[model samples]
Target: MNYTADSIDNLGISLRTFSKINLDTVFIYPTVANKPYQIALMHKAANNTYSVMDTYNGVTLNNHYIASVEKKDMNFFTATPDTNTNLGVTFRAFDSLVLNSVKIYPSQIGVPFQIDLKRNGTVVNSYTGLTDSTTQVVNLNFGVYPPDSNSIYNLVFASNPLINRDAYAANTSTIKYVPGVIRILNDTAQGKHNYFYDWKVAAYNYTEPVPVNFLIPRDTAADAYKIVFTDNPGAKRDLGTTTSLTVPDGLTINTSTDQGYYNYFYNWKVRTNYFKFYSPAEALTLFGDASKIYIDYPDTANSQNVMDYTYCSKMFTYLQTVRMRNTLKNNVAFRDNLVSTSNLAFTGALDAW
Candidate 1:
């Protein structure tokens, strides 16, 4: 499986397999020195058309001539454009996927240019930057677009100053095409040019399997949970007898769907306390009493000056009987006055003492 060329695209590898075997890593050895190469996997259909499966972009000749490739969700296909023409390519996503970026070969470096990702002749996302290299990858802000069928996309390129110059790399001899992934519709400038640019269109498969897990509170009595999609309200999934839930393809967690828990406390508050005290009551009783107190106090505070008036009143009532066993052993009337005055009398007594 040795491919020696200045540039390669759509290189095929035939594998005859009878039993299921796992492919962990792919090793690619590039004889050329100091060159970067992209290795990708494409699946051939029964109709003899090919679609991108997975692509590895980190392959280069710098890693001791051996590039260990791993399967990623990214898929891309490249085409060579005409260097003499300032044209663009119109294509369509054969499957539902996120259009990640488009890498183009620019003729002039450091020149300002704009690349637009248009859907059905309308610009949806645009990338503007100074050309820095021969291969400039333009990234889009929108993660996904057209989200459905019947929508076509165009990758239009334009340079500043409006000069008739060589802006992109194109191929006139062979027009690269990947069905059900990316199919060339037409040329933006010339109709039916039968040529495509040296543009690398990369995308992530929307239906690609992504592993997901959900964690539920241990104290919650909800034996069943339901996950609802925000984008599609009608779509829902029920978690039965398991805390782990299944995430379907094309649905993003938190972004596209919202997880719901039934029979659980909706309004809950959290408080952190560093001081631990041993109580004679049961754990459940202590927990219940602690839940009612929203404000926490350190073990020692000088004169209760920092306490809020309302919270201080609540704390004084809760600790009134306990304080009676200490310095206020015989001061029942004083404790009552402290509570009635909203702990102001207690503050005055502490200041006087």
Candidate 2:
């Protein structure tokens, strides 16, 4: 519906004097004598801020247009403001949504002026420039982040043109990102076997294209591993005796949520080595008092069986496995005996037994 000064004046005609008047309807009303008419109250427009031009200040407003990320455009005509003799030129409008803030960039070279900011027809903030017609940017309004960050703020540039005759004003809208209300969980899960360690991770962010990294200890200090992922459940592998590893593909989340979150698995295999030697020649052979270097074990455990004899080159293989209990800590042989019978076996006997 269109509203204008002429339409408002005509709507104020007395129905008793005019037979053509639709006085029976609530939409028609007698005008208040000697009072200027105003536009009736109405709901705000969807997804847009209302703006108009003021010819008194040489202001020329163009139609507003909405643009999308896909380069689509939707345009709406600007609503001409109805002048108020009492308040001069005033605009009563609202923005489509909550906003982060507003800023004004003055393009005219004149006196400096203040701009008032509002939302839902309520004054929120105001900003004043330093000098007359300051050809720079100024903040008109500021709001809470993470909440109104994506909202569009309603703006009203109010100035005393009579006092600040040298100032001119122009402003722009700003939108920002505030973290969303999302929770994340990152944890490690133990597998059925003690040799393996599994992990699970999660997180949340406010935007897309998130970067992430995962850190895990190497088998040895000299090894290094770097993982570049683009999706969740990124990479999973068995950490063999090798000390080095590489990151697999498709582990990045790319979203603000779970930006740099990660989880992992590490399966460690305990290692132990054993070796023993002896001779089955004559008792106390020529080379009497035989001696051998005994390499110590990092941890201790009981051996099932071992050999006490050796002839030529005896073969001694090491046995490694997982323990159900703390045998290395409580076993007597693990503490006192350097080598157990099951730990190693010899093919030959000692020259003297």
Candidate 3:
């Protein structure tokens, strides 16, 4: 790209002059393939003042000087540490380092702590119910899984996408954290490859089905008033409005007044569009039938049903046909795509990004 001068002369001449010999500077962006490189550009202005600016990765600056012109661009690269190597530790690999928050009466004195682990932005393991009451903190560790074979793990947080509040330091009021290293060794360990790379941390909560309960008030007009449920999460029909409301699969409602009071549980149910698969057994029970079963696909922003995939269809068809053939049904041969195998029974959490 060519640049123009600031002003034009009276005779339509340009204020700036161009040199016949062009000057150019080439900067190679340091990458995980090589190492992280922080580049800085330094230049001296016509007035002899010097300045420097960071040209992180993709940015590049070029300067040209012919006469006594002082301005010239200087570039240098600083290697960024490789952070996501799986340095042989398991439980600490994929955990969201949570800070403990505990205090005594009147004065809430507490200490903050943070753990850093590297991750490839795409694949992250999940751990639920990681907590330490005394520290008021927890981390989600992947446990023994090797870091991605790709070797280059991008900087990503395990929690909220908008804000990462994971890394922290001990303090009374506020705690702060920042990425420290790119290796996977333990800070205090004397063993080799016992290091760890720290990146920004984010707090994350997985999507879960809202629980609800229903209760029918002791209305004097004891008409046969049963809750006609349309579609409340997984409970297809209404749990009969009786004296004591018992929800088999847990409920969030407390009352059963339609006209006078609004049912908050029912309202919440209507708003919750997705439900969690409690266990692998639950998933098999719900989707074991030959017919296609619809499951919430959180990875695709919960848009596409996993059952709709061609691979899923083939697997189901194959399984069903095997049973059918054994039961004296028509024996027809077919092919199945090897790509559609599923080891995950429960759906993963929605993409935090």
TM-score result, candidate 2: 0.20
Error of 2 at 234 (Å): 25
Error of 1 at 112 (Å): 0.7
lDDT of 1 by residue, 214-310 (tens): 2211112121222211111111122112132212211111111113212111111111222222222432354435333222334323233334453
> TM-score per candidate, in order?
0.30, 0.20, 0.16
Output the TM-score of candidate 3: 0.16
Better of 1 and 3 by lDDT: 1
Tens digit of lDDT per residue, candidate 3, span 1-353?
01111111111000111111111222121111222222222233456443332232321122111111000111112112222332222222231223221110111113222233344434544422322322222333332232322343322223311111122222232212222212222221222212222222332221122222222122222121222222211111122232333122222223353323222122222111222212345435645543322233224223233345444333333334445444442233422211113312233333254
Name the better of 2 and 3 by TM-score. 2
Q: Which of candidates 1 and 2 reaches a greater TM-score?
A: 1
For residue 191, what is the lDDT in candidate 2?
12
Give all candidate RMSDs, comma-separated: 25.3, 35.4, 32.0
RMSD from true fold, candidate 3? 32.0
Q: Report how far residue 269 has shifted in candidate 2, in Å.
A: 28
Q: Local distance difference test, per candidate?
A: 0.37, 0.23, 0.25
Q: lDDT: which candidate is best?
A: 1
